[model samples]
Target: MVFKCQEDSFLKEFTSKVVTCTEGQLKTVIGGKITTLSCYEVVLEDTIFFPEGGGQPCDHGLMDNVAVLHVTRRGTEAVHFVESALPVGKLVKQKIDWERRLDHMQQHSGQHLITALADIYFSYPTTSWWLGEGESYVEFDIRSVKPLNLDKLEDLVNEKIRAATPVFVTVYEEGDTELRKVRTRGLPDDHKGAVRIVTIEGVESNMCCGTHVTNLSQLQTIKLLRMEKGKKNKMNLYFLVGGRVLQQLSACLHREHQLTALLKNGPADHVELVDKLQKSLKCANKNLQAVLREIAVREAACIKQQVPIPRYYSLHRKEADSDFMSILINEVGDESVLLFLTVGDDKGGHMVLYGEPATVAQLGPQVCALLNGKGAAKGPKFQAKISNLANRVKAEELIKQYVTCTTSGC
Candidate 1:
């Protein structure tokens, strides 16, 4: 059955009698929240709504002022999922979401033009295609695409669009001899309608089951964004058609303006300025690391100079790293005094416990548990990553108590 939508893609209003309406549920995500809605599955005698198929999404519209959330084809029927139910025999006025319909038409028709030109000029047959929310692409049966060939293909596609080539659908009954010559992956098993061959006059004819513009001029323009590697030895040619091209341009310009302000340079100089900034940052980090190592050595020397070296010591540095920890450990070189050191922010960081072998084994597990950390004891050194640095004080107190008990024999 060729529905009214397929017959006249531009139709926005129609009157149809509801053939059936059944209670149903629909789940949708809005503003990052998943919401389930109670709805009615309605079948009309005729409709202007296009059901989801052929890589194009379903149309959303209204029936008798009730919101139509979605449409899907089941066998031969176009089921309309609506927010409210209507009587089975009631006649309702159906309206199309014209903006969405126009966008889909532009993209679908643009795809046919691109696919035909690719096969004709480059012998790259389209194995598959995707109509995404922001962009669309055709997967070709090639591993990679040359830049020159890609540029040539894009030019030819837009040239055809500018020529305003005629696009029309030719319907054939099943078993028609001409249908065999039309390009197609295959028809669905549940298909119960005449085959649709969408042809761009003087271009190509391909079997499709999606709504399209009547002329290539409706596409306005097509921009082949880039080519990306695809699965199974294929390449995907991503593109934006019609309004999407304009939208992408607007977004890019906005980001360019932001970068100009941030870099205090024009768009042409952004790359050079950013490269210089990165180099400067690298040099500064190198100098900071040297300073941290020197501080670590001085801290270790202070500990070693104590009148009667403290039995236990704890130090935490929010910005230090493992290199600083290693330098301090090497400088101290005393197994008699236990050293508890941590390096990280308040959120989390690395922890190290260095002391007598037996003392480390006994206190490592306790401190790890208190600070929500995990590590293993190796001889006189224990190292771990702590997740709850907020509990660092508690862990330190536990270490002090254990050292005091061992030294006082209490």
Candidate 2:
């Protein structure tokens, strides 16, 4: 219920008082009389909460020390809907969640840097940036962003970050404007008296109302997570910044420690260890598959020699998984009988019964209904989880009835 991003573009540890609150559905915030108000998110109303827009989430924190749950908008009027109700016409101080806010700022600022850099270094334009959960991304129209130049971009952004450069805003009156004259999608339809533009002193400037760091220094650093071509003439880049990068580094180190303990290798050898482990796994899996194939051949030969009994056949054992029954049933062929059952305590299984498509279609769902669980119908093989070996004889009889009696519909 948070209508974030409705206020001035700042995520400082600042506090303000609540001017009003709403109690009805929608629970909107109204300060001045309904007539004078803009009906949704206006700074003129002096409401503390930020309005939600531009894909960036709303600012969150406490209002009068109570957790603010929702910061929604009613037209241009922004409201803070909190866990604890506040009285209208009463002023309640509010604070912004700085950690979350700073992360957002870093991501927002980093995006501008990357976008500008792409235009500068790769001569590509950003199509859009879909800020993700924890991670942020910027999509560009460049087909190949080779070498990725992550380090170069990081250095360039940090230089701006370290410079502590001030960001400024300007609003242009309808007739006197040069910056707003250039447009990506063309001038906004609601061309009023003025258009707002944000500028970074020595680096770059563009039209944006999105919140950003007051001083570029707050961004610290930008760490590129990954980059890949998204579609024709498009590439997507994922990245992190400041505290988030630190957290990721910590996690990676711990994982490396775990690998070193098991592999008994130096930290720098992590790549070699991973490659060796993958190779070993592949060899082991290959050997296991060969053994399973050999076992399937021998077992099918034995089950194939069984008598052709329509609607009924079973091989019960205390320990055997589905592979045993499946091999035997398939090798027995499709023209003959159907119901083939197997029983086990440690291992669980079942096989075909009139395995024709229509028969399984009718029996499978019914069997699962009686068993109170789930199974698969693969070319007419149905399996059920039974509690004990005693269910074996009972299951065999059930299969016979289910297969032969069409009226049973199971």
Candidate 3:
């Protein structure tokens, strides 16, 4: 059935009797959390609420002052999901969210203009389109789009909008001869009503079931943002229409102001200042690596020169990485003296143990378990990623006790 919304896209308020109301539950996500709400599926005699279809989201508003959470088309009926049940056969006032409806109308109407122009000027047919929450895009049959062509097309679209061209709908019953002239992607299998042809006067005529503005001027303007590669050899042209264009401009200006303050420079100099900051950071990182390597050499040298040699040595660095551990192990050079080296802070890090192969195989699993780590042994070396560095002290004590017990023949 053609809904009241489809009949007149500009209708904001209407009165309709509730035909059916059934208790139901709806699972939806709010604020990034999944929630289930007990609701009622209310079918109105006629509705101003548009059901979700043709890539446009459903309308949300109030039915007799009760929140209508969602609306969906089931065959020919528009089912309204509401928080509370409405009395069947009672006439109730239905209100539309005018801001949301206007936005959808602008974007939807703008899409028709772009689609028609692309086909007329460039022979590019629209394969699909998306009306996203933040932005929208139309997928064309071509594999790629040129920037120059996009600029030309965008100019043409806004020219038509500025001209204030008329846009209207035409309805055709089954087997109507005029229906043959309208461009369509074919009707849904369950479609059971008159075919609605949306026409942009002197531009194009296409079959559509979504709400649209009565004139091209309502779109305000259209901006082709960019093109992205899509699956199956297609190109998606992302865009903004109407108020979205103003919103994007405002957000960009806000970000530019923030950048100007942070960089202590005007907008034109932001790029140069950022480049210099990146180079400075790179140089400082290089210097830090050199100092870390020197510290590793000193640490290994101190262990090597110890009197009578130690049975085992353990060292942990909170601000180091596996590269530091490798440098320390290479400088020490004696696998006979067991080495227990760890890098990173109390949260997590890397660990390496080097010693006699038999002792390493025996104690590696025990130490890994104690530290909530995982590792594999290769010859006399055991390497692991320690997840619970808070247990580092316990792992060190275990290694020391095992070595002392072995030496004392306990």
Candidate 4:
């Protein structure tokens, strides 16, 4: 199989018949079983999934639909951290989603253009590069800006992109980066590996971890999304590149179409039409409230007529929810032997006992037990609703019972 035996480094590529995998330095096909597949880092004999080094993300791909999410290297050994189980020592082919990989390249390359433009046209030095959300941005050292020469800068940068200058990436050791007069930052002091740099012809020379396009044209187009002001000496230049610009344009067009349909107006008239519609909506709401008030006033008389006595218990509204019964009980109630009934879905309406405090207290317990209602009375006055059929007959009986209890008491 022309395989070279190694201790802790990548061995040879062979049509592995079977693999006896284990927690080894690198993924190797030995016996026939796989082991230690869940750890974040491993050593693999052959893998194209690039480890997360510098600031660039770790490359992700699948082997037989088994996802390898993160890769890490120890010494010269590369480990394949996979999500699923795999047959040990089996020869597996690799497949990568190129669209994702190329996207990272475009975003990373576009970042260099923006960072360079800042220095060349605005004298703003970039402080950081956060490659996130499949996009990247250059954070300038100085956040404050009076105004920018946007037109001139735009023309100048476009000219450079059109020039399609050759871009080169390489690794440098130690002080070689500083000696070369290329800019670098965010590197740890203890990092001993090669410091990667991207050099554009007659343009930017900077350190970065993100994968970048080989040529300037691959960056396609970079449209500045916004420049956000931050703490002292910090400004974030947010941007979109390549296909992301088209996505933004498409979304904006869709929103415009939706607004036009909703307002029943042309694009140009949308704002004015929306305002008119809002005013109409407010007037309709006002009209609705007037109607409801009229309805409530009409029902009040009918509710009072239904009451047999000049009792405190009167339904305030015909179409009242439980809240209507509750508000009526609280406002009109006095300490007297009383029963409140509102025919609707409610915990029977309020009841009260009319008498001295001592008499009401004596009868309160009997009323609560009989009507499935609750409350203590000052006189015979308690307020509750007779909502349940089991307690309906007892509603009148409880009043009579309380009458007997109050009159017979000391």
Full-model lDDT, candidate 4 = 0.58
Residue range 1-410, candidate 2, lDDT tens digits: 11233235563444444455545333433564332221221122354345454445666777667776555444445655565556655555667787776677667767877777667766768888876657888887877666647667667767777778776666665455577443233344533434455567766776654567667777776788778879786889888877788888899889888988988989998888789889999998777656755665665566566565444445554444566556656666663455445445534434334366666667665655443435667665566664444444555666667656764664
Decide which is better by TM-score, 2 or 4: 2
Clashing pairs in 3: none
Q: After superposition, which runs of candidate 3 have C-alpha atoms over 4 Å from their true positions?
A: 30-37, 307-318, 329-410
Question: What are the root-mean-square deviations of the candidates from the true structure over C-alphas?
Answer: 3.7, 7.1, 3.3, 11.2
TM-score of 1: 0.84
Query: Local distance difference test, per candidate?
Result: 0.92, 0.61, 0.92, 0.58
> What global local distance difference test value does model 1 have?
0.92
Question: In every candidate, how many clashes are there?
Answer: 0, 22, 0, 41
How does model 3 fare in lDDT?
0.92
Deviation (Å) of 109 in candidate 2? 1.3
Tens digit per residue, CA lDDT, model 3, 159-180: 9999999999988886788988
Off by over 4 Å in 4: 1-41, 45-47, 53-55, 72-79, 85-92, 134-136, 146-155, 177-180, 231-233, 278-410
Write candidate 1's Cα lDDT for 1-410 as tens digits.
88899999999999999999999998887888998989999999989999999888899989999999999999889999999989999999999999999999888888889999999999999998999989999999998888999999999999998899999999999889999888899998999869889999999999998999998988999999999999999999999999999999999999999999999989999999999999999999999998999999999999999989888889988889988888898899987989999999867899899989999999998898888898989999999988888888889889988888887898
